[model samples]
Target: MAQAAREPDFRTRLQEWIPKLVLSPSVAAMVVFVYGFIAFTVYLSFSDSRMLPSYDLVGFGNYAKLWGLSAWWTAIVNLGIFASLYIVTCTAIGLVLAIFLDQKIRGEGMLRPIYLYPMALSFIVTGTAWKWIMDPGIGIENSMHLWGWTSFEFDWIKDRNMAIYTVVIAAVWQTSGFVMAMFLAGLRGIDNEILKAAQIDGASSWSLYRRIVIPLLRPAFLSAFVILAHLAVKSYDLIVALTGGGPGRATELPATFMYSYTFTRNSMGIGAASAVIMLMTIAAIMTPYLYAELKEKT
Candidate 1:
């Protein structure tokens, strides 16, 4: 009898331990790779590191230099433009596509995948393709010239004044489908009875959507905003592939700024400072939303 009881207890403990054992490596990886590096970066930001990390503390000198740099300011300005346009454009396009798809359209199963296909490709791929498509000498402009529309000028990728908008365009193209999927899920989860009741109450389609349906998609909107904002903040690969932060740093973002300073410019301490600022910016946007979400769940 004691042996039988011991066997069951052992099995129960084994089941619990197995999951922890499976999860331990991932947890440790996060702790080390994510949190550990973050802490180390923070330390580097306050030190006098240059080209290589040094433990000598230099107070806030790096941050002061980072702020005073014209290139860093340019990156901040570009980020503002890119993030704002990226969020608004993606959200608007996604909402429209979701609403269109929600009409019980024929071939939705086929069409949804078509819309989402761009997201399957990495940002690097998207940017590289857009780079070719937007290049004045080889892309749309050249193609237009060949097609006998020589006046066509779509050289925004190489134009300093308009280069940042190109980044926004590529970002929106890649992410809007994902946002649409999120909103579509939200739309489908809405209570159909409420929609029917609203329809019966003589609500026009516009009024019904404005008053009831769109409001119900608040969670989806929040999620999309957070995700798009985060993507916009950390957008290095896309910019590298697309503009290489070129046209004289017109499309430079903070991520690129950090990389250039750390690896290329050999200003490691200032780069670390820029990285810390980027982290704080993301935390500022995320902390409140996460708190509210967790609070609601509890």
Candidate 2:
């Protein structure tokens, strides 16, 4: 009887301890891999690090230098342009494609693969193919001239003013198809009966789709927007393959800037500062949509 009275206290202790025991491995791994490494990076960011990771305390001296750097400033401004164009173009084109394909048209099976196959390939392939096709030496530009159009100059890749748009073209090619797939799945899940009822009420196709279909796909649009935002903010590979921040750094983006600072320049402190700044920027940009998404989820 006395042991039974003591059981309650033991059980309470056991319940409290079980969670720690259960979480021990994951916690350990996160500390070692995530938090530990992040802390080390942050520490390095404060010191005057170099080729071999110097540890002399320099306070925020590197950040002061970073803030004044023209390249960094250019990269920040250019990144904003890249991301805005990417998000807007991808979302608009993807939505249009998705709505068109939702008509249940014939040949969709074959066309779908052709449209989406670009996504299966790496950005390396996308960049290379696009670069070649737009190559000034022997691409569509020359091909167009070959076809008797004497003055067809499609060479934005080399233009300082318009190079970033070329990168966005490649990005949209890869990402828009994926967005279309997302919206198509959302469309399929929607009720056809609602459309039929709308039709019975003498609703025009434009009004029915606009007033009904678009509103219902809010979840899909919101989801796509969040994803596109994330991708745009951190986009690196395609830009590297396409331009390498080229034509006198006209296409320099935040990701490429971070890499150049960290690896090429051996400025670890500055690099970390850039990375943390990028994190803050991404969080700021995506927080509103993310909050709405979470509210919906809960």
Candidate lDDT values, in order: 0.95, 0.86
Q: Candidates' TM-scores?
A: 0.92, 0.86
Please identify model 2 stretches exceeding 4 Å from their true place: 1-27, 285-298
* Strongest candidate by TM-score: 1
Kindly list the per-residue Cα lDDT of model 2 for residues 168-208, writing each as its tens digit.
88999998988888888888989999999999999999999
Query: What is the per-residue lDDT of model 1 for residues 1-298, given as tens digits with 9 covering 90 to 100?
Result: 9999799899999998999999999999999999999999999999999989999999999999999999999999999999999999999999999999999899999989988999999889999999999999899999999999989899898899999999999988898999999999999999999999999999999999999999999999999999999988999999999999989989999999999899999999999999999999999999999999999999
Clashes of each: 0, 0
